[model samples]
Target chain A: MSYHSVVMVKQVPDTANISGQVMKPDGTVNRSKLPTVFNPEDKVALELALQLRDRYGGTVRVVTMGPLKASDLLRDCLYMGADEAFLISDRRFAGADTLATSYVLAAALRKLQPFDIVFAGRQAIDGDTAQVGPQTAEKLGLPQITYAEGILDAAGPKIRIRRKIDQGFEVLEGTLPLLVTVVKDAAAPRPCRAKRVMAFKNARTLLELEKMAEANSLLYVDQLKEEYVSKGLFIETMTADDLDVDLARCGLAGSPTKVHKIDSVILGANEHETIPANKEGMYALIDKLMDDHIFG
Target chain B: MNEKKQQVWVFVEQRDGQPADVSLELLSKGRKLAENLRGELKAVLIGHDVGDLAKELFRYGASEVLLADHPSLRHYNTLPYSRIVSELVDQHQPRIVLFGASFVGRDLAPRVASHTQSGLTADCTDLQIADVTYLRKDYAELLLQIRPAFGGNIIATIICPDSPVQMATVREGVMEKIPLAEPVAGHIAPIPYTPEDCDELVRIIERHREENKVDLKAAPIIVSGGYGMGNFQNFQILYDLAHLIGGEVAGTRAAVDAGFIDHNRQVGQTGVTVRPKLYIACGISGAIQHRAGMQDANKIIAINSDPDAPIFGICHYRIVGDVMEVIPMLIDAYKHKLK
Candidate 1:
């Protein structure tokens, strides 16, 4: 059977450059203050999926569940030769931790059926939680191979992958329909082919189409959407109506965790003690560390 | 409801038929945690004819050593190793699984955690049991794992809320390895292995080891050169100092950008986080990213001409002299001592 892979991608506000002014009084990030980029790892994942498609002769679908601003990454995915792309944008997907985010992504993955592989980045740079991929795999009930370094070999049904470990790497062969999380060193992503980029430049999600229609009168929103859909340039924008999503468990209502506070703390050494390389000296060092609450 | 007492599992990582040092480190930590919770500390040893390691593990603190020895297991393969680990974890539930945050730990922990439906926290600098008695009742309570967050600005204590086993991959030097003066006597229980246990199909064409770069993670004395070493040529000075000190030369994000060192040598938020005994910061302004990587070092001495450099903020001793001047002086002082 041919392989069909769907790579989940995300566009997150660049958290590395977050300043005091980046967070407004409302607790939401001021998007204008900070730039947004396609998550670096997710891009690596997309490349790995595309490579699989290139090697095995299959379709690579790119999916993103984010706000309308996320359509930019989806179009870029199309520019990079993804066979299909979907934008899961609704008010419900906002403010999701790894758990709730996995719920939404898994729901979306279920809607896009018939895939032998699902590739995801090891973790998002912003959150650095690295929980979403494994959680999604768990939800899908598929075998997962994370931190995969290279696709060693592949035959019918079973695919062999060389995975990186602490000291060295290990090779593993698993049956198809596997979920693999690619690392940054796995593969460098290919640049978008110029032809595809030009073709998909006009791709728009439903929300973007609606905004365009509101801004101009020459074209109707439906007319523009249908035109792009025929050219395979329109992102299949889905909402709560598209999937069998539990309304309660879909968004912030489903999210039970809340960030109470955020602070930048600086740690300085309170006391200094040096010990000799003897048993007695070692005990003294241990005692000091325990007294400082650094060790117990 | 009292939390169910879970057993502790240690991965006995062996390379070339010998056990790794980190395995002993995990056994030491595992022993303490297991003792505190009144749980069995089990060591999972997988290799060819490595049954002898079981006795060593016990000396360090392992109560039981689960040895899986097979010809296919001679070389570490993620497929077989993860399969065995996942199976062992499934058969005998481990409340906590500890791995040395070495390269292997970084790779294997994620795969095993995902397979067992457990949560894994990677590259933790600290591990502690926070309220063990109360948590035994909750299956989802994560053993509090703490690591530096936001470029060493704060220490974030993380827990895996739902996974039964709270797992963390700790950096090598972050935890002290317990050294026993004499090997304590212990017994080994051999875990059976079969051909089916080995599933890797990738054939190795070549195994060429690169010239050993100073593994910053393993290095005790890390001499890190930053942007202040004005040109790429200045990095050589750092190499000289590092060679004399019998350590590795590390670089801040700025120096890495200047093409002073390879990507693996980078120390920062996006780079490798190292906790060395003595981290000498030469000629680099301490960016948050740069500081995050090396802030865990035991003794930080910042050598910069500018007194107000951020490196001075975290350093134990701030040398307000130029790196070019100070590095030469130190090098001369050491040379004189040797003479």
Candidate 2:
């Protein structure tokens, strides 16, 4: 039997390239000011899902919850060999923490049923909360394996996984219909193929098509969407209303955790004695460290 | 039931019938929070034959131990454990809950919090109870969950104002486990649980635990290399030094990402946070991310060519030189001194 794997991906602001304007006065990050990229660990999760689909004959579908602009990441997934992509975006889903985000993702997963496996990144760099994957699994009544390093076997109804624990690694045998949050070092994500990139470059979500139609007044949104759908280039779109999500449990209102304060912490050593790069300085430093029992 | 009177619960995680160190640490921290809020500190123990472990919690400052011993609870299966914990939280309506940010705790805490519709903050470095004014109203006792964010560049304080239970997972090694003072008089409350007849969703057919070569968290000394080590061959110097000093060799994420060291050896936010007695940074330009994991070490000695590398700023002693030259001098000096 072919295995169907759903990979949850997110378009996160590249926190590595944060600027002074990245943080607002209110303690929340100004995500709009930063350039967004596909979350790094999520790409690794997609790579694992693609490898699973390659070994077993099935399809790899990517699902993401973000704004309409997240369609860019969905297209990138297609270029990297995802068979199907779904963008779950809604205005009501804005300002969602892990809880609300997982609630929406779980509802979307229910809509995309009959999946044998689910993959998610260990954590998103922006939020740094690794709760969505396990929280989604809990909501869906499925078992979860977090910090998965590699998959050993997945041919049968069960999958053997090597997962990272506290200090070392543990090989766990988990059954099918499981959610596995992949670690960053699980596998190197394969580069997007040029041919696939060219083929799916025009893939557009329904919202994007409407925007395109609006930009070009002569073009009809319905005709453009129909053409894209017929060409298998339309990324499926789901909103809060489409998912029948509880309005109270969709966004900022649903999120219970609030950021009380954020401080820009610039770390520095106030009084460090700088030893010269000469042998005398090095010897003196060593003598001091040894005297202090730091070298013992 | 007065929700305010509910006790602060710490999920006592165990492995091989021994209580995890983080569990004891949380019990200590939970005791303080309970005292601040004028409530009792409770430990939730879930495992077969964990009755003895319940008493151990009392020694660490748990006033009440809620035991959910069952055959299915022998191993940490998410479904059964989370279901039981969620049920307990719903019934008891704990004001706050704490978990160790271990592998099992990280997986289980969020699941339990989600099931109970509670707010959870993961990998909190510090937890405190303080009063705050929000929207012109006073919150008398809010748990200030403090944690490093943005790759350790900033600290974010989070509060769960809406949820009945404020849950958080504290990182291991961040908190010190208090010594067993005079054992406080505590009671063990056993909760009866029966495994459901439903088929097991995920079954652990086999578990192969790797032989740990290095326990960085418990290491007394760590000689860690970074990208400045230049190449994979350079890491040998660190290993040699650590071997000489009865320490372990660790690396920064840059060194690990560059394939100079294994991911397990990575010492940073994504890897393991260590608080060794001594941490020697060789050729590492310490970023905040790297420092976040090791800054808690008692003493840090940094050797970097760049006089202005961030590592020097955090290290207790700074030697501005090529690590290649400095490490050799250290190894030679230490070897001769030992003789």
Candidate 3:
């Protein structure tokens, strides 16, 4: 028996590279200034989905909600062996917090029905909120296992998962139509194959095709989209209207969280007593630390 | 719900019929917030036969305990717990809800918030109540959910302006719990919960627990190594030192990634946030990601060959030497002193 798995991925700004200019004075992120990358943990989630499909003989569909440029990440997913990729993009879906984002994703998932499993990264590096997957599961009325480290078995409608807890792990058995938020260490993500990368290199979303036609005066958008679709290179794109999502629950209007302030914290130790790199200095340092009850 | 009788609720998490430390910590913080808002601090507990823990909650500053006792809830399952908590929130519109940023809380809070359409902030370092104005609308007594973002380089203060119940999950060890004092008279409100037919989809088959490990959150001293430890074999020295000092050995994300340590032993933004009494960094260069997790330690000492290591910047004492060389000497000196 085959299984159908949907993996939710996101293109987040590389927070590790964030600098002073990345944060604007208005308490909003300067997205253009930060380089965008496929969120690291989402890749692991996709890897887990691909592994399940490889063993179970089904399909893996990767879905992401972001700007049109997120098509870049969709192509990466395709290159990494995703059977199908969908880009849920719309200006109306902008400025969404985790709640609104999950709402839109739940709506989109409902549109793509009859899925057996859904996978998402534990948390995004940018927002660092491990909320969306569970929230989406709640919205879809599905069982979710977060902090999933490994899939012990998946056969038919039953799936056993090894999930991480505070100090240990628990083996959980759940039915199909389940969502699992995978940790980064769950599995090592497979690299893009040379053949798949070349084959999916020209993949373009409908929005990207429109931009291509707009830039090239001779190329027709419809003709290019048709050609790409025929070549299995056109990434499926959806909008809020296409998904029939509630306008009120689609974006900033639906989000309850509002950023009140942003502060740049520069941590420093004004004064530190440096000990010499010798035996006597080591003894003295140990004495000082002991005096402070740092060690006995 | 009347404005004057509003309550602040804390999800009192438990394991093996004992209240988790983070639960007590949240109750303590929830009490202060409840006092500030002029409301009662209520602890919402869901478990099997956890009625006796209500007194413990009262001692920790909870004015009342709302408990839902059931055998199905003896173990933490997401669906039933979320449903009960969501129903409780809907029945009684608490102004603010707090949860410990434990595994159970992280999984349950968002589900409840989604069901009730309330906003939730995750892994908050601090919580306060203040007036907030957003988009020309002013909200008084909003929960200021402060958390580190951008890998601890920036702090963002969030407010739930639209939701009636503001929810937050606070990181463990970031807040101190009130001391266990003389038991105070408090009310226990029993919440009768019966699971729906389809609520039990996931079942725990077996639990594997690591034995004889110090919980980094509760560890008074953490002897942690970083990428500078060089190899997996070098971690043995750290274990030895930790054993000698009666502490636990933890590592940076790099060390974990290098396969020198397990993820549970990792201490960083992506790992566990630890606030021990003393944190010793060995060969850790101290990225902001690592600093965000342990900068709250009461005392920090760094051992790095590179004098310019950022770990030294935030540490109280700096030893400009190789950890491999320094740790051995310290261990020897300590052993001699003890003898």
Candidate 4:
């Protein structure tokens, strides 16, 4: 059984640590000041997809749509036994929210030909929306298994999965060509094999070679790209024109949602009237809570 | 003919005759939403003969309760509960459906939402009715559901623009339970939900209650430890202080990662969010994720070796001392006072 799977990965700023310097006067993150890494959960999703490929003989291809620098996570994916990688980088692919993100990912995925399954982390830790997986499923018109903790078994077109619910787990079977979003507890991601890491270390996208050419007059962009492709280090670069994405819906122009404001709220405790457990005291406490909109 | 008003519905979550506190909190919130919309507050209680619990919901401001009581619904089998909820939702459409952000709600809501083709938001921290003027009357058009995003650095307001009925799972204790004001007036409508009409795909082997029951969500006072506690043995001081203060012992994800406590006891973005009356952080350098979970607590006191610990940023009081030493003195002081 040959299993072909594609895992969507993203590089997001570490939103967990916000200091005074996080936002500049323009209210945007000073990207250079913050650490960017492959979303922790998406890496887990990639590991799950790769493991499925490893169990059965198949190819695992990783596809990510972001800036040129976003190729970092793609190379990381290659080092983890991904057979192929594609980076959809272009100036037109900036400021994409979940809705636009799903469109871009689905478009990029279409160019990769076809696959048996698509896996994404339930949600990116940075956004924590849990919307992309379902949105992508909607875009691709596929049955989705969201919050999948474990894939129990896979036989041909049918797959048995255990989805994590709030209380316990739900066992469900679905057909092939489905989108599954895995949770953190799905499986621990394996560290990159030393040999594979070394082999793919010099893998560079075409944009990187162009940058090297601009920096040093002695370097040749075509030769470096050729060498990297031989080593399987080059992430197959794609653009809006390559995916045939409608210019209107490909980036910020396609996204209708707007962030009205980003404000940090410091939650403070309200005035409280403490009382004893007696009936009369409790009544006063309740009245105060109701008055303060804390209770009704 | 009067326009049909949509009713506010609450999913009465229970297990082994024990009602989750989140159910009461949802009811407490449901009462307000119903009042603002000029609708009735209703509870869809599903379980085996939980009719006796109807009065309990009414005490928390349920105007009319709908009980889908049956033997098959006794234990929480998702197939039956999902079917019952889906059936009721189809029959009598609710404007808003609130569920406890517990394991059961997380499972049942998504299945029912998918079944009904409705929108559902999980683990919402804040909920408000957005009023808009239409046809010379003010109509509530959206439920502005808010939840911590970016690991608690910001709150994202989500609206289900197309869905007729709005739904959100409320985190436990995010809202306070309302006290019964002179025994509320309400009626019980027992909707018979039978096993014959349901499909059972799951088998229950054996249900075991966890012995070490430290329900940090319901605890009023919690003394929390973090990575700064150094080792597992040093965490005992946190336990001693919490025990002395008549509170529960909790830990940050760091402590959980350090193997000082189980994952269930972790308090952070990936763990439980607690809003205790008094929260004492022992040696915990608060990260944004950790703060998101416990920042809702009433009075926070920090005891960390470093004065610049981020925990002090949100703490009501800061004790710039080591938890290994400070906690013992506080424990001894309380003991001496008790004596």
Candidate 5:
């Protein structure tokens, strides 16, 4: 039996490749200056989902909740073989923590119902919270397995996952319609297939179509959207209004957690020694440490 | 202060019938927090036949133990653990909840938070209770969940201003674990196992646990490498020096990510927090996140080719040169001295 998998992906600031201009004077990041990459772990999650889809003879639908710019991430997902993609973006959905995020995601997933599995990265590097996937599972009323390393077996409605733990691994069996949060080492994501890129390169969400229409006066938003839809170049777009969610729980209002304060930590310099890298300096340093009984 | 004492609970995490050190650490920190709020510190120990762990929790400042002992609850299955914790919080309406940021805790906590509709934060470096005003709202005894954000470029203080229960997960060794000189007078209140048929839907078939032999936290001397160590072959020099000096080899998050070192030996905010007696930095340009784990070392010696590396500022000795040159010389010097 084929399974229907919905993989959640995110576009995060490439924290690993920080440039001098990316850091502001206040020590907080100028996030706009930092280049964005498809979050590494999320891409791995997508890869695992794609692999499952390949083996089980099914479709992989990818979803993301971010700014309109996140359509680029969805395009990358399409290039990697996701059969469908959905972007849930709205001004009201800003400043959402994991709980609020899960609210919107679960609503969007409900809108596209009857999916058997929801796959997500173990944690996003931007937040490093790892809460969104499990929270989404809770809201969806599905069992979740986090830190999933690899799928050992999947037959009929049952799937067994080998998940990573503290310095170890465990094999767990869960039924279909469950959530699995994949870790980074789970799989190396396949490169974008050249044929898929040439085909889906023109994929545009409704928001993107509206932008294009605005840029070209000759083009109307409705006509452009219809043309893209007929060409199968449309990325399904859902806004806050489209979701059947309580407004209060959609954005910052629904979020229980708030940022109290931020501190640009500047560590006070302490007294230190300057030792050369030469033989004499190395010997002296090791001797001093030995004298202090720090090393044998 | 509210006349009714606040309820502060720590989820006492156990694996294979042994309590996790981070749980005890939270109990220690929870005691201080409960005191500040004029509250009670309770340890929610949920595992099969783990009633014996309650006394240990009491020793680490838990005044009450809510025991959920059952055969099914022995291993950390998400369904029942989240249900029991969520139901307990719902029944008592606790003010604060703490969990170790371990795999099991991270897996179970969000589900519990979503179920109870409580505010949750992960990997908090510091937790404090404070009275504050925010956005024209006055909050009393809010849990100031402090964590380094944006790749440790800034530290953000987070709070759940609206929710009654503020939950946070702290990585192990972030907080100090100080057990009381004398155990507190606490009693175990057994929480009965209420079955949900859905709980059996997810089953743990087997576990492969590697008894982690790399105790970086307990090591006296740590020869730590970073991404700047150049290559995987360069990382071998660190083990050479570590062996010569009776020390352990560790790596920064970057080195670990670059596949130069294993993650268990990683030292950083996301990795193990180590405060060894001596930490030798090898070609490491330390980020604030990396420093958070090793900055507390009694004495640090940074060896980097770039003189401007951030690690140089915190280290006791700054060796401005290649780690390749410095490490082998140190190893050779040690071998000669021994001879």
Candidate 6:
């Protein structure tokens, strides 16, 4: 029997880059100015799912609850060998904290049923809260294993995994219908296959296809979608309307937490000692540090 | 009908009978927060044969210890640990629940919060109790979960206004673990552990906690690298300088992500905090996350190619040049001058 696994991913700002985001004078971040990338750990989670599919003879489907443009990320997943992809996006889902995001994800998962395993990154760099995976599992009433390093065996209903903890590692065995949150060190994600990239680059959601049809009057959205589906390039998309969701629990309105204040990192004034890079200046600075007993 | 209780819980995370340092630190912080809310600080201690740990928790200011002792609960299996904690929170509602941002706590806290429908904030740098007025609703004694967001560009103060129990996972070393002068008498509250079939679904096979050979936290001097170090091979220059000064080597998150250094040697908000006597930054452009970990160093010397690098802002000494050029020069000069 073939197994099926769903991997949850996210598009996050490139927070690992030091210059990714800038702080405004009002103690807020100018997030629009930053560049966005697929979260690093989520990519690894996708890779693990792909490996499981390859070894155990199954399929890997990726899902992300993000903006409509997150179809770009889903396309990336296709290029990396995902069997199928789904994008869950809606304006009503904005301002969601982890709890709201998990609620929406669990709803989408329920819609896409018959999955044996679920995978997710340990945390996204944007919020770094790392709550959505376990929260989603809780919402779905499934068992979970976090900080997974590698899968030892998954040929049957029971799976063994090597997971990480504080300054250590543990080997764990659990049954199917489990949620596994992956760390970046779990696996080196394979690069996109060139042929797959060329094939899936034109993949678009229904909204994007409609926009395409609008830009070209000769093409009808339905005809365009029919042709795209014939070519296996139509991406399955879901908005808030399509899912069984309590509107109050899907977005910021459903969020229980609120941001009270934001602040820039404050540093006290320092008496900086500027030194030249030349030999004489470098030697003199070394002597000064030595005199102050800063260097032994 | 639930009424808000004046009780704060600090989960005592233990492995093989030794309590985690961050758990004690949270107990200390919880002591003060409990006082501010006019409540008792309860430490939920879960383990086998760790009953005597209650005194240690009390010495760190736990007014009461909730003990859940069972042989199956000896090791921290997420299924059983989270199940017990979530059941207790449902039975006895807590005002605030604090956990360390360690692997186990990060894994367990979210599950409990979700099962109990509690609001949780992660990686908080500071936690305090305050009266909040949010959206025209007055919240008395709300837990202010302060943490950096958006990759450390901004520090946000988050509050759970709707959830009955507010939860947060605080970074280690951020709070002081102050023991009470006169230790409070330890009060034990037993939590029954009825074995459930669902709890046995996950079992631990093998576990290993390695001892750290390089203790960066205790280093007198550190030679830290950043993404600007360029490549893995170039990290040799950093090691050269560190060994010359008899110091340890570390890096920012950028460097660690770039594969320039090991994650264990990372210094920043998400990583271990360090306050060496002298921090010599090489090719490091300091982000707020990196600054939070090392801003307490007695003296900082930064060398970077970019004159506007943020590391220069808090550094005591700034050398605006290529680290590849300056670090070698400093290593050369140290041998000649200090020797």
Q: Each model's interface RMSD (Å)?
A: 9.6, 3.0, 3.1, 9.4, 1.3, 2.0
For candidate 5, write residues A165-266 as lDDT tens digits. Answer: 887999999998899999989999999999999999999999889889999999999999889989989999999889899989978999999999989867
Kindly report the TM-score of the first chain in candidate 5: 0.97
Candidate 5 chain B least-lDDT 10 residues: B330-339
List model 6 lDDT by residue over A1-296, tens digit each: 45699999999877665342355665466777767899989999999999988887889999998988899999999999998999999999999989999999999999989898999999998888889999999899898999999999865788999999888899988888899999999999999999999999999899999999889999899999999899989988988899999999878987878898877776556789899997887899888888878876
Winning model by TM-score: 5
How would you class the docking of model 4?
Answer: incorrect
Ten contiguous residues minimizing lDDT sum, candidate 1 chain A? A270-279
Give the C-alpha miss distance for residue B330 in model 4, angstroms: 2.8
lDDT per model vs. reference: 0.72, 0.85, 0.87, 0.74, 0.90, 0.88
Best by DockQ: 5
TM-score of chain A of each: 0.84, 0.90, 0.91, 0.85, 0.97, 0.90
What's the ranking of the predictions by lDDT, best on top? 5, 6, 3, 2, 4, 1
Chain B TM-score of all predictions, in order? 0.81, 0.92, 0.89, 0.85, 0.97, 0.94
| Candidate 1 interface RMSD value | 9.6
> Which candidate, 3 or 6, has the higher lDDT?
6
**lDDT tens readout by residue for model 2, A83-132:** 99999988899988889889999999999998999999998977677899
Each candidate's TM vs. the true structure? 0.76, 0.93, 0.93, 0.73, 0.98, 0.94
Better of 3 and 6 by TM-score: 6
Query: Candidate 2 lDDT (Cα, whole model)?
Result: 0.85
lDDT of 1 by residue, A1-296 (tens): 45799999988777655666875665445667777778878898899888878887889999998888889999888888898899998887777655566777888899888888889888776656566786676567566677778787778878887766544556767777778888777888889999998888888887888898999989798898888788877788888888777877667555433332233444344343323323444345335434544334
RMSD of 4: 7.8
Q: For model 3, what is the alpha-carbon lDDT of residue B69?
A: 88
lDDT, residue A233, model 1:
70
Q: Which has the greatest lDDT?
A: 5
